[model samples]
Target: MHDFDLHAPEGANKKKRIIGRGQGSGRGTTAGKGNKGQQSRSGGKTYLGFEGGQMPLYRRLAHRGFSNYPFKKTVQVVNLVEIEKRYENGETVEPGTLLVKGLVKGANPVKILGDGDLTKKLSFKLVAVSASAKEKIEKVGGTVVSNETVGND
Candidate 1:
């Protein structure tokens, strides 16, 4: 027996208080805009960064620092643990193969770090390999091809 009929009566909703109507509307004349000056006139809206004639905030903040090294290399790193889990035994792994397998992306250099055990022998061409990773690979009868030397010439 709950009443869901709660609503404003017919025509009970007050009409929105309109501005800039005309002098006859009472809200006309200045259209409730008040007496002269910047705000009372038409097209008085200001820009977002404006501070009512004061210096803006953006210009007050400190700006510093410079970096001359523009061609710095950003190498994407992969650990041996991840490689061991994703790769198959006796498979040759390379940057292109890793990219095709969705293990790595882009032309960014790949660095392999030793973090887990390698039970399978894998021949890999990588940009960088840790000493431990290189040793482990060689111990497991795998080959490590360095990309840095290949890219230099």
Candidate 2:
């Protein structure tokens, strides 16, 4: 049988040596900080972005381009292939409908590009469509409600 009471493992649960107490602690005098300097003093923390009193990396790098226009249109894109696969013949596709189907998100305008063939005659109201997409939709006897029409109405 093992003697559990007599042999409590050596150095188990040893207390941490508290520094800066007195000479008895051995780590007293300089509190283990080693002779005085900038680091030995209190509140010696340096700013993270400090580059040893040199110019920061951000300032040194050259900024090349400038955007003068503040309000540039940022549009969400949907491909014609995705539309062809998702919608049925004679279906009315709109932004809200697309959102409901989890195809697009956010407040950005949606632009549809012609990437695949469409067999179904779908009537879609979109923010923008490629010239090929418009042609394809018209060729298939489908109605494409353009951004201009939407703006007019």
Candidate 3:
């Protein structure tokens, strides 16, 4: 009972190294894929973005992110006759006085949209105030100041 479970046990089913059939059988001639390049012939494939030619791993990697229009938030518009041709009825149009009067370009969040006309009773301390610009700024008696008591909202 030794030879472990006897019979074909020690090197089970021998004889499958039968390559290209010739060079006296030791994995025959180039059947072990060596010499004469391109992996020794016969359907040898390697060329559609191949890497053995050095520069290919998607051309050796270096191009990423955004192929256009996935992130769109460039909303910066103000009206109500451009805040009564620039504040002065109670002056308080915040976002640091609309970036010291050049009206917008970073304070990052200022929405105010109502599109034209208002006789000035101005006072917004703003950060997002539309509904026809808070109904034309409370129909021209103006007084917005409510961004939930300015908790950086």
Candidate 4:
């Protein structure tokens, strides 16, 4: 249609709800606050897990066990099976190459795991190779060169 004829669609512009004006206004008196309670009063609110005059469940339960998950390293993983399927013999495997090959993404450090049989003699660089993975690669006449310590997982 024409630019000058343009207008917002139906209900696109809504009137602001006017509340607490008077009894004539539907949302007046209690202003839709319902019956009297701790919530009906001004600035009356309860903190999370608060129990009225009683101990909260959070305080009742024993705070247990330390978890190392938050502190654990988040490494991008590539499997030996994937390497066997994707690369030719003697090609270098690294995070950048893995990204191009669509095996892994992002800037996280790549860790190679021994998940499948590898028949090709490929070389790995700048990536952590797991212990079992290193064994498989060596058995297949491949080599791994890493700046980081070899991972066990």
Candidate 5:
């Protein structure tokens, strides 16, 4: 077809329904919102879980059980392989050093995990060490100074 013959397909460009213009427009006055009460007035929509003058389901049911999420402790973990890559032979590995080295972040406690080999004789302070990781650190002449226990033995 020629460029001048181009035209939109039928029903593809229908005009939007004009509402609340005047009574002669058919959709005017009420604009399909129907007569009066909550929905008819401005900002009169009911909130979610709202029931018509009765107790809502969320309110009728008992709020049961306790949550330990509020008292839960969050710990940041680092592996031995990462320490061997970032730290020197005699340098200390702690939360602050780990943060500076981009191994861990935030103020949460740090826990070292024994995932790979460690050769440097480093010192660990103010951090927790897993049972397996502690053995690995001591074997490499590294020292772990914290008494805070991490995961289950």
Candidate 6:
């Protein structure tokens, strides 16, 4: 019903246009590609960012901007809801412990986020912990012994 929407009416078979089938279909000899040329031939595909034998837009534009992406470190994150489900009260939560629980694997930097309620008095030894998460953990008699130097955050 919208101007830009493409919706076929009910009972409309909507067969695809069979190009180069026959002349009766109005796509006969040329098939809308015109006479002999590179595009007219079968399997003649063009690579992306290609121009008509001219300099591409990417080449014409100035190479500007700097990215610190390569130097940036990726952080592994976990939520309070999941932590409560995995560990029991008075349990220690470290990166190695998280690996065993399938919460975080490898030596990737881990961060604890506070998004839900937690009642366990667990001990935290993580790379990073949000301010709210630390407050919540402390509120529940949990200890946050974080080493922020290990993570990018």
TM-scores of the candidates are 0.67, 0.64, 0.29, 0.59, 0.63, 0.60
lDDT of 3 by residue, 8-126 (tens): 56777776566879878777777788899777887878978887878887867789876768765665666667777888888888788887888888757777777777788887875
TM-score of 5: 0.63
- Note each model's CA RMSD in angstroms: 6.4, 5.5, 12.4, 7.6, 6.5, 12.3
Q: What would the per-residue lDDT of candidate 4 be over residues 1-153, giving only the tens digit for each residue?
A: 776998889999999999889999888899888989989999999888788979899889899999998898888988899999999988999888999999997898889999999999998899989998999999988888987647576
Q: Write the per-residue lDDT of candidate 5 for residues 26-125, one digit (tens) a residue.
A: 9988889999888988899888988897999999999999999999989888889999899999999888889999999899888898899899999999
lDDT of 5: 0.88
Where does candidate 4 stray beyond 4 Å? 1-50, 55-70, 149-153
Stretches > 4 Å off in candidate 6 = 1-55, 149-153
Error of 2 at 140 (Å): 1.7
Judged by lDDT against the true structure, how good is candidate 6? Answer: 0.85
Model 6 residue 89 lDDT score: 91
Task: Please name the candidate that would achieve the greatest lDDT relative to the true structure.
Answer: 4
Order by lDDT, highest first: 4, 5, 6, 1, 2, 3
* Clash pairs, model 5 backbone: none
- Sum up the clashes in candidate 5: 0
lDDT of 1 by residue, 28-56 (tens): 87877678989986798898999987988
Residue-level lDDT tens digits of model 6 in 57-150: 9999999899998999887889899999999998999999999999997898898888788999998985488888888889989888887623
Q: What is the lDDT of candidate 3?
A: 0.74
For residues 26-76, what per-residue lDDT tens digits would candidate 2 score against the true structure? Answer: 889899898998689998767878787799887799988988679687777
List candidate 5 stretches off by more than 4 Å. Answer: 1-55, 151-153
- Kindly state the number of residue pairs that clash in model 2: 0
